[model samples]
Structure formats: structure tokens, C-alpha cells
Target chain A: MWDTFILNPMINALLMLYDFLGNNFVLAIAVFTILIRLLTLPLNLRQQRSSMKMQEMQPQIQAIQKKYKDNPQKMQEEFQKIGYNPAESLAGCLPLLIQMPILIGLYRAIIIVLGSTPQSLFELTARVYDYINLTDLLPISNKFLWLNLAQPDPLFVLPVLVFGTMFLQQKLMTPATKKQESKGKKQQDDNPMAGMTQSMQWTMPIMFGFFSLQFQAGLSIYFVLSNIIGIGQGYYMRRSMAQLKEEQATKKPAVIKAESETAVASPPQQSKQDDAALDAAMKGTPEERKQYQPRKRTSKRKRRRR
Target chain B: MYAAKRPLRRPVIFLLIIASYLFVACGVQTANTNWPGLSTDGEKVYVAYGPEVVAYDVESQSKTWSFPAETNPTLQFFAAPSVQDGRIILGDFGASGGMLSPGVVVTLYALNDTDQGVPGSIWTNGELVSDRVVAPPLQVGDQLFVGTANNFIMSIDATTGAKQWEFEVGHSIWGQPAYKEGVLYLSSLDKSIYALEAETGQELWQTELSGALASSPVVNTDLVYVASFDNQLHALDIQTGQEKWAASAQDWIWDAPAFADGVVYFVDIQGNVYAVDGASGDQIWSQQLNLPVQTSPVVVGETVYIASGDDLDAENPQGALTALNVADGKQQWQKTAPGPLFTTPVVVGDSIIVALQSDQDLLIAFDLETGGQNWDYLPPQE
Candidate 1:
């Protein structure tokens, strides 16, 4: 079902465009990139929503940490007052995991089939290159300026572009945290990427750049255009998520106490009520805190960008 | 909890594998390992190309006397021609090649004479279905012995193309039948060497080898030399096809074996050409060509000719036909042409005609002594 309904249809559609465009392989790759990015828009929006929610809950989370600064056990308890799970941030990258084959398959399509190297492809292997119209974008030549759409660029332009766009897309799509959690070196070791998720975001582009070195120029073009579209999509979804966060301001604060820096300030009249609730949460079993506590607004903000 | 992730990872891995295989499977024929045609004496030259038969003047460096495969369906050269008794015989291997699956029975044709492009049909002879009768009928007196791709080594009357005898092998036969005295030496993909009674089609004896034999077995009195894909040149007893001796090489030895004086000359696909003592199967000298050498070695008296292809690239594309001194393995002279070459060299009368190929898609003839252009007849440069 997955192959027929999603992958093959998409593959055949790209091929049809390649055929229709007179085998213009470059345009086919560009159109394919645009189509896939557009298809995943909804899922991208949801991830961004989650991230936005997480970001909005940050102020309240900061207050909770200050309140129990010296007591390690209390800080952990106070953190439970507003929910924050670092592992949950990784969930925002789920769409990439789902789209991995499409990305890699398209890369391979450009190399093994379209922009073939004589030394690598062996004889006795059945080859069908007619399926793609690589010649149509004629004057667009697989060679543009210094780029050889056929082989990986030796000048490293394509790969660097791939790397730069990937990092930028990661930045624009992943919600930035207002505060960096600094524990002792021990805490840093416990979560190896303590603040490095953002680093990994940039690292993805660099890694993709290396892949570009061995892959074809047509694939690099796809990746660059895809990231460009993704950035635009992220900004649009971010605005929508910001509107949702504004509406939620009327409701009870939704934030993990440790993450709340501004939302920690509740009305003074409601302080006694909040303190009583905090005492109930403190007395309650850990599982009870997990079940009753609301999701952080910052998590939603994180989700929004995701 | 991780067990749930296992199935999820499986699909990702499976999709990745499928994608990689697809990438490897889709490339085009960006370059030709070669385009081998026949020399004048009806011998297949070079490597990989089949139907190893040629005539001195008719064949170009290209695979066909005419355009091999034409987009125009109506323009078919149904006449497959070869020479016997100074006449060119023609016939079909009784099947369709290229895109179609051919039938089992093949038909053949014979020619007597030609002046320029005009030909006088010497005789019309039909014998069963034998597609690859590439080597002109070896007309030893009256018996015309030839090999066919349809798995038969048949002898026909030199005058009428009537079947005189037939010998069957284990698998389909593609190499030309090498003849000397009353014995006909034949090679088969079945990995067996056969010494057949030239007159009766009776197998004198057969010796099985380790690899498939593709080149026609060249006989020098008591020793029979055959090149096999098994990477070894085998010298068997001429009378019984028994192992006389063998020397292993580093690459696929597809070049036809040639014997002169006491030395044997052969070329490997890696461009290594060798001279070995025919009496002892010991290497005397070895030399490498500029690019891969797939052309079978042809020796006439003191001169041995072999063809070499150039490094196929967007620029500086060319190929060569080299003639060497048989005794010392030193090059006498060479002929260079543009693009990849697979045509074997055939020495006939005053002209050492080499059907050389050009990027212009024409078959050119070069003077044997001077290496100058002799004849340029083909379509314009493609």
C-alpha cells in the first residue's frame, strides 16, 4: 500500500513530468522537490505547533526552577508542575524520518539513472534511461556555469549550497529555546546534545553537502529548492501558530514550571490558589503529576515550528 | 518499547535498498566497450562481439557490411554473405537478432565474385539454419567446412553448399571452425574442445576445459591453442584434444591464438599482448597497449596485427590498429583512427586491408605499409 499509494505514484509522476518536459531532467527534479515539500505541509505545520507551544511555556518553567533552585528533589518536583520533556523535541524531526526514502531515492535517481558516469555503471546490467527526459531543458544544460549536472561538482559549490540551505531550513523550522539549560558537566554528559539539537540542525546541511560530493548535481538542486520551500512553509506555519498561542493566553497557563520564565508570574490574588494546587501536585504520586499537568505552551510553540 | 521501532526501521531500510538498486539499474550505454567487425578472411576480431566472421574488403570496422541496425524497418540486409572458392556465400542463421526472438532454423547465401559494390551470385546454397557462418568457407580442395551458431559443425560441398556431414556439440557454437590438413578444430561455449573428422563430421576426440571457449581454436601442427574466458590459454594435442600444456594469464584471454616460428601470440582484455614459446608454453615477451586490447592477433609471415581502443571520454577520443613483428614482439607500424575500434586485420594479396572505424561512422581502409587512408565508405560522421 505504501509503495503503490505514496512512493510509486510519486515516482511515476516525476517520470511523467520528465517525459512531458521533453526529458528535461533538471526541471523534473525541481518540480519533484516542490511537489513533495508541498505534500508534507500539514505534517510540518503540526510539528511547528508543538514547538511553539513549548516556547510559550518557557517563562513559567524558569520561575519553577528559581523557586526550587537549591533543592534538587524540589526542582524536579517543581518541574513536574509544568510539563517539559527534552526527548519530545526530537519528535519534531519525525517527518524527516518518514520522508527519508523519497529524499534518497531522488538522489539515486539523478546519479545511477540520469547523470550516469561511464566508469561506474557496468555492462550486462539492463539499463533503461529513456524513462527520464534529461535533454529537454536543452540550453539549461546539466552544465550551468561551473556545475556539471552530470557529475558531482569538483568546485564544491553544489554541496556547500546543500549544506547551507539544510542548516538554514533547520534553523527556520526548529523553534529556538529562550534559555540554554546549564547543569554541571555531569548534566551535559547525561544529555549529550544538551543544547546541541540546534547544532545537529546545522550539522545536517554539512552532512548533506558531503553526500552532494558523491551524488549528482541534479539531486543537489532538488535539495536546495526543497529546503528553500520548507523555510517559506515554516514561516507561514509559525504565523498561524503565533495566532493560536495568542488565543490561549485567556486560559489557564499551560507550561512546565522549570521552562516558564515569564508565564511564571500568576496574578497575586491567585497565588494562594496556585500554591494549594502546587501542594496537591507535590503530594500527588509522580504518575499523578504526569497525568494532570497541562502540556507546556513552549512545547506547543516547539511543535508549531516542527 | 524498542520492538515497535524495529518494524518501523525495516521499511526504511527496505525502501533505501530498493532505491539504491534502482539507481544502479537505470544508467544508459554511455560508452562502447567496442564495436567489433570481421577482417577480410571472415574472422571475427576484437572482444564480446559475436558472429565472428569477416571478408577482407567488404567488412568495415563496424559490425555490419551495411548499417547494423537501422531505424527504418524496411531497409533490411537479409542476405548474410561469406566467401568460398573465391565466391562469397550468404545466408541467415534462421533467426531474428536485435529486438526479436528468432526461430531455430537459419538460412545461408554464397557469392562468387564482386567488382566494386556490384556482385555476381556465384551460387545459391541453403543448408538448414546456421546464423554465424562468419569465417568464409575454408575451401580445402573440394570440402567447404564452416562453423555455425546453431550448435553444428557442418561440411558442405564447395561447389553446391550441399551438406556433406554434421557434428553436434554440448552447447551452441559461435566461433569460426579452424581448419588444417584433414582435421577441423572447433570451440564451444560448453567449455569443450572438439577435433572433428573434416570429411565425416565425426568427433576425433573432445577434451573438456574449466571455462567456456569463445575464440576459434588455432592449430599449429601438433599443438592446438584456444583462448578461454577462464583466463588461460590451453594447448591441447592436435590429434586427441588432450591437454598438451597450459599457461594462466591475469585477465580474460579472448584474443584469437596465432602461431608463427616457435612462438604463440595472443592479447588479453587488459591490453597485455604476449609472445610465448609454442614448444614449451613459456612466456618470451609481453607488452601493454595504450588502452584495453580485445582484437584477436592475426599473423601473416613476419607481421602480426592487433587493434586497440582509446580511453573513451568527451575529448581526445581515438583508437588504433597496430602491426607487430612476429619474432621479437616489437611493433612494426600502427594505424590510429578516431573513436573505439573492434575490426580485425586481414592481409589479402597486395592490400593489407583493415576495416577501420571512424567517429564519422564510416569504414575506412588504411594502406598496410604506409598506414594511409585507402577507402572511406560509410554514412557521414554521426
Candidate 2:
């Protein structure tokens, strides 16, 4: 099932791109990565929008939790009034989850496509489509610049670039850290999600960069190109989201109400707090923003005691 | 809510690491890179496949001795061992000491074959080359010639394991070089045949073909025949590296054409067997088996022995050894094997020895006359 649906199609598509791109495998990889990023643009945009909305609702959410601290059911009703659902925050990870399969599939494809050994060539031939004219394409050119696409880079150039580009992408995607928040609030906001994302910003890049040391140079090229495309996508999403926030801030009260009803409905009384929360969410660190989030469930005994 | 979300953080990172490792392993692990290399010297057969090379006695029908008493995971032996006198010479795929080392260091081992239990290396030259030796080493007198995957052919002192001279080619050499009349003939993936001086490693002449030559050139009286990945069989002038005649095939011709009775017999990877006149390159008879053939057909008496693998698209892939009449390409007899037969079968006395990549059997022998099983040998796994 994996081969027929994911591997075969990807291999063929890559071969077609190779054929069309003057048989330059590096160009084929770069173009293919860009196309894939474009295809997933919608999901990325949706995830970014969800993050922005969640950031804007932080202060109001904190206020509701404080006002209804003793009344558990009343707090739940107020959360509904503000149209805040904690589950929507998980959507921020959806786009990343979707990319894992693509990475695995493309890795397999590159290995076989640039295969220099007889067994790998035989395996490639078996997976190739009938129309590809594999006879003419028996030996794919694997050289580009100082790299033999089938082997790892000897100069450590690609690995460094992979690390640098991935780190930049992670930086762009992660919410800015808030440096001005009180130490107590910062401690309270040290949630797992924030900590995970922060550590991932370093760990993910370092891990992939380490892998790039042993991975084929062709795969490393893909990693660099894909990370670049991701960085571009993040930039584009940030610009559009900022523009949307600006438009929302300048809108009339009736227009804002209509838009809020369709999206995450916000009470008029909390407008200034929402603005302050948005600023903190957009400019502060993920850990700082996470401090305002309410716990999902409370102990029944604690509620009964209250 | 944050605390509940915290648990997911560790698991996500752990899963990502696990998945990355799995994907990296799938890409980096050495799977089937090449087939087993087989050679025989009348009394015993030498098989080099994975980590070790073993010599099996033909008459005793028992194992004689295996090189390298203990298998080393880093070293792989796939090049056929060239046996001459009491010396067994072979080259390894290559290995390195992890990331600290820059490139792989391939070793050329010359072992004392007279050892009855496990042969010890007489001398090993590991510091000379940094590439995989795919082609079998050709030893002439006290000099040994080896072709590597890095597109270089080197001449070493057979007795001292000292590098004498080296010559670079346009591409990797996968076929054994044929040495005759003080000239060494090599076929390369650069789609050319190179003629180098046996003693000095100097190129006398080179003839460019339309496709890569993956098999060694068979030097006859005046012409040397080579099978090409260009789907053609070419006979080149042994002296000047001039093309004499070319015969076309339906697919890539992988092995060198077997010359017998003024006829050259060869098979393409698409399983098309052909017999062409040696002098004129005119096709005599063509037979289509429509399977995957990578081994050269060996002509013995009135029959030609050909080995082929089953369709790779098939669920349970198998292989077959078919004997065909030399005159008309008529099927005389055929026997099936549990795995793919990629190595060329060697005729030792009355038995044709076939090496397979199968787990159940590594080497199988059949009666050359009747195509009946003589014996099968499976090496002990590490």
C-alpha cells in the first residue's frame, strides 16, 4: 500500500521532473520541493490563522478563569461565550505532522533515483513506470558542483546550510518570546507545549543537521531547499496575518461584531484586553503567552469542596 | 490544559527521532548492492558474497576453508577471488572507521589457499585504495591489475602487495580486465573499451561505444567481444581498439559474450539470448525467454548454459538454469532455483557450478550433461 500509493507516484513524478528539467537532478529537487510547499500552503495558512486567533484570546481567557474561579460550570459557560476552544490550539501542529510522510517518501525516492549500485538500479527499474524509457535513462547523472548526489558531502557545506536554514525556519514559525513579562507569570506559563516548541526549535534543526552529515548529498540538498521554501511560506503567512490584524483593528464596531460572530466571537467589553493579548502573543515568547490558558479539566472533589 | 499538552511534547519528539532513524536506516543500510562472485580452479570453488570468501572442495563435496576466520561487519567481499598456484587474490568492497575517517579504505587481500581449515592472509594492502573494488583482480606473473569503482585501475606487485602503477578511466570499471599478449583489455561504464599495457598501466588505445560496457571483453583470435548496456554486442579490434561489428539486442547486454566454435553467445537483461558469428557479427539464432538475465551463457559441448531470474514483478521471484542447443537455441533442459542467479556459472570438471543470492542455497552444482543437481552448498551464516 505504501509503495503503490506514495512511493511509486513520487518516484514517477520525480523522474518526470528530471526528464523535463534538462536531466539536472538538483534542479528537479528544488522545483519539486517548492511545488510541494505550495500544495500545502492552505494547511499552513490555516494553522497560522488559528495561532493568531489563539494569541488574541489569551487575556480574555485569563480574565474569565479569574472571574469564575469558584464557579466551574459558569467558567465553562463564559468560555463558550467567548468562543474559545483549547482544542483548536493543537491545529498548529497539523501542518508539521503532514510533512513527515512527505519527508520519508522523498528520501526513499532520492535514494533509488540516484542509486549507483546494481542492486539499487535493479530496484529502481522494478519501481519505474513502463513509459519512462528507463533504457535511455539507465545512468542518471548524480554530480552537481562538488557533490556526488549519491554520497554525503565531504566539505560539510550542505550540513551547515541545512542546519542554518532549518533554524531560521523554526525561528520564523515560533511565536516571539516575551521578555517583559513578570517572573511569576513566566513561571506559570512554562507549559509543556511552549517548552516543547522552544526545545524543538533547537533540537529539530540539530537532529536533522546531524542526519545530513550521513545522508546523501542529494537528500541534504532537498532538506536545504525544503527549509528555504518553508521559511518563505512563514514569511508570507506572517505578512498576511499582520495585514488581517490591522484591518480588524480599524474596522467599525458593527463590522467587527459581524466578523467576530463568524469567526471567534469576542465580547466588545474585552476589546482593549484582546488588543493587549494580541500584542503579547505576537511579540512575546510562546511560554509567556501560554500562562493565560485555562486548565482543560478540574477535579470533581475540588469543585464539590468549593 | 498546558500540563496535558506537555505530555505530548516528549512523545512527539521521541516519535520524530524514531521515525527519522528508521528513514535514515532505510536509506543508508547496505542491501543488495551486487551479486555473489564465484570462481573455481578445478579442485575447489571459491565463493565471495557477504563478509567472507569460502573455498569448497569439488571432489570431497565438503568445505575446504573460508578466508577471515571471523567475519568483520565493515568488510564486504563481492569480487571473485583469482586463484593461481597456491595464492588466492581478491578485493573487498571497502570500509571506514566511522565519521573520523574521510573515505572508505578498500583492502586487497592475498591469502594462502593451502590452509585446510581457515586461510590466513599472506599480505593485505588496505592503505592503497579508497574505493570499492567491483571488478575481480587480474594477476599476470608477479603483477596484479585491479579496477575500482572510483574509475581507476591499479597495478600492484602480486608478491609484495606494493602499488606499481595506476591508470584512471572515464568511469567505474565493473568487469574483470582481460590480459592477453602483454595487453590488458578493460570495459567501463564510460561506454568505452580501454587497452592498457600489462606492465606499466599505459593506455594504448580506447574505442568509444554507444553505451556502457558492464562486462569484460572476451579476446578471441583477432577480435574482443563486449556486451554493452546500449543493447548491443560489439566486437572490437584487440590491437587498435577499433569496432569491428555490432549486433543489436532488445535490452541491456550485461555479461561478456561467451566465444565457442567461432560463435559468440550472449544474453540481454531482458532475457534475450543470441548467437552471432564471431567474424561477421551476423545473428545466427535469437531466442526470447522474457526474463531477467545478467549472467553470460557458458558454451559446453553442443549446449549453451544460461541463467535467468524470474520476473521481479512476480510475488515469489525465482531463478532458472536453462541449457540450449548451440545450433538453434532450442531449449534442451531447465532447472529452477530458489533465488536469483546473478553470477556466471563456472564449469568445474563435469559439473556447472551456479551461485545464487538465496538464503536457502548459496552455491548449486548440476551435471553438465543432464542438467541434474549434483550438489548444493550453503555457507554458515554469521
Q: Which one wins on DockQ?
A: 2
- Per-residue lDDT tens digits of candidate 1, residues B118-141? 444545554354343433345567
Full-model lDDT, candidate 1: 0.56
Candidate 2 residue-wise lDDT at A258: 39
Compose the digit string of candidate 1's lDDT tens values, residues A60-132: 3433543454686877756655666645667866776768877755654454433221112211112223453
lDDT value, residue B104 of candidate 2: 50
Over A129-200, each residue of candidate 2 has an lDDT whose tens digit, in order, gives 999976665457777998878767768798889989999998777654331122232322333334555668
List DockQ, one per candidate, in order: 0.02, 0.22
* Alpha-carbon lDDT, every model: 0.56, 0.78
Per-model TM values vs. the true structure:
0.46, 0.83
Global lDDT for candidate 2? 0.78
Best candidate (score: lDDT)? 2
Q: How is the predicted docking of candidate 1 categorized under the CAPRI scheme?
A: incorrect
Residue A16 in model 2: shift from native, Å? 3.4
Error of 2 at B21 (Å): 9.9
